[model samples]
Target: MTHTENTRVAVNGYGVIGKRVAAAVAAQDDMTLAGVADVATDWRVAVARAKGYPLFGATLEHVRAMTEAGLDPAGSLDDLLGAADVVVDCTPKKVAAGNVERYRERGIKFIVQGGEKHAVTGHSFTAENNYDTALGRQSTRVVSCNTTSTVRTLSALKQAGLLKKARGVLIRRATDPWESHLGGIMNTLVPEADIPSHQGPDAQTVDPELDVVTMAVKAPETLSHLHYWTVQLTREASKDEVLGALRASSRIAFIRMADGLVALNSVKELMADLGRPHDNLYEVAVWEDMLTVQGDEAFYAYMVDNQAIVIPETIDAIRALTEIEADGATSIEKTNEALGITGRLVPEPVAA
Candidate 1:
């Protein structure tokens, strides 16, 4: 809480998300990068060492060598768990359930990656919406990239009382076969029909009253994921109102309102021009030409490079949970309220 007192933070599982989180934490004045936990000899461990971040949960000999080399290294993950005030679980979803319980037992607070299926009581955070839900909470989950983008845009519409029901279709590119163990090599445009992608459901978790439908397809390209969305509104809202609302939302960085047409490539170019290096979690690029509204039927479309959108939101969530002053909670809270989902409570079921 004081300048001299650093928020000791550890990142579990050093992958893309873990790497980004570490960098963000390092950049913060109120927090210190305590260490990273991953299997010994993993690329993440190597990266942590290279970045001068302490290595944890790695081989004892390797840790000692790194420590002797003038790097801070913890002998094992247990040391990190004991020393850190906050542990961010960036491990894959399949492994998160077990790890979350362990951190809970250790009496350490956590920020969980949203892809995991574990049941946690913490708030679901996105910078544009539900930041307060995470701020001051002992545990919080950063919603998946797709969910963050969907909810931020829709929450704005919902707040304006314009949204009635929402339906979405996603076309996602697979992580390069080398990047993922899942065999995506030579596989192009594989559709996941009838299976509900987690994003829609996660959005509903934030606002249960939201009726949502979602579909997905996976491509071989590892670049970005695209989403096509439709919303039925209570009344016919003008296109200007929709565009104006989107522009005003802080979580939304790049939005173009061009005579009711939105395009993905334009948004992508805009981000490039803006010098946004990471698009997955930090930025949500929107095309004005892709948006269409006619009568009560409104259609919206956009593409989000997952890595840019998710990473920044993840960083913001960590800062909020740790009560870091510079994380800009006020801006996040104000944007969330403007999006119409502020203080919207999840309903409790009645006994029959």
Candidate 2:
């Protein structure tokens, strides 16, 4: 195939985020899937190859193994970078620091997932909050999924002139859905005794202007990470006003019990029914039925799918770094349209 002027994007790891990012790049009209690399024998290497991504091995040995598996990778990690404009490093947390150093040494453009510290790239990205700041960044860090939701909800409300401060509780899943080898706690666990969990400060990494404090507890469910938000608004708001704002926002998707998919399980069912890639709901699922307002104080409940919500942000980061789209809304809309992320994924609430 003849290459055009599209920005070439290589995915450095074929784990959850890497696979998703690679697919997203393939879907983008302005981007091309240069290649993807992963460690040896990950099964997903074949998945990448089946998806038509030029497979590269994370190590030389991985290359040989994948070649035996008939994926016939292009080369090793170095070769992947040599052929690409940008690398999206989606390796595990323990592997990220070393990868970050390599990207820096090679003078290659890269975007790291939220697992790493904000300093990993020195440009924490959440398109709704700081798209312009990340434009042309040599190293970009897409904030973690939890922080992504907090920042997105806050950014839209702040822009609507209806928010003051927010305090949230992150009901985190005990483990990633694909992590079946690791057993999760049967009882609820509070990993952080601190009044505000690290996510509050992490959200600040993306939106320092938005005042947010967060706490966390772990639930047994691996389906989704649920969050409860209590926000103080600058002025009184009605439920309709809040819903109107969210319905108008670019990245927010609302689902309610009236839609006949009240709980998280049924939500996943809906995504599966829609034939979503990997059954992923890429948007932060806000519960419209839970939006409550009382005398300038409002409460909201939402869920973030760990495997999915961050995909769009990573795509936006690529465009921002490549200077293809300077405006957040434009980049976000382009990415959303390319990925088929239109209006709310849930059906409209049945007449109550």
Which is the leading candidate under TM-score?
2
Candidate with best lDDT: 2
lDDT per residue as tens, model 1, 297-317: 678777676765666666666
Tens-digit lDDT track of model 2 for 22-83: 88899999898999888857667777777778988888988898888878889999998988
Alpha carbon deviation, residue 288, candidate 2 (Å): 0.9
Candidate 1 regions exceeding 4 Å error are: 1-4, 40-44, 58-72, 121-123, 176-182, 185-187, 255-281, 325-328, 331-352
TM-score against native, each model: 0.80, 0.95
Q: What is the lDDT of residue 333 in candidate 1?
A: 51
Shift of residue 107 alpha carbon in model 1, Å: 0.6
lDDT of 2 at 349: 70
Lowest lDDT block of 10, candidate 2: 1-10
* Candidate 2 runs further than 4 Å off: 1-4, 347-352
lDDT over C-alpha atoms for residue 282 of model 2: 86
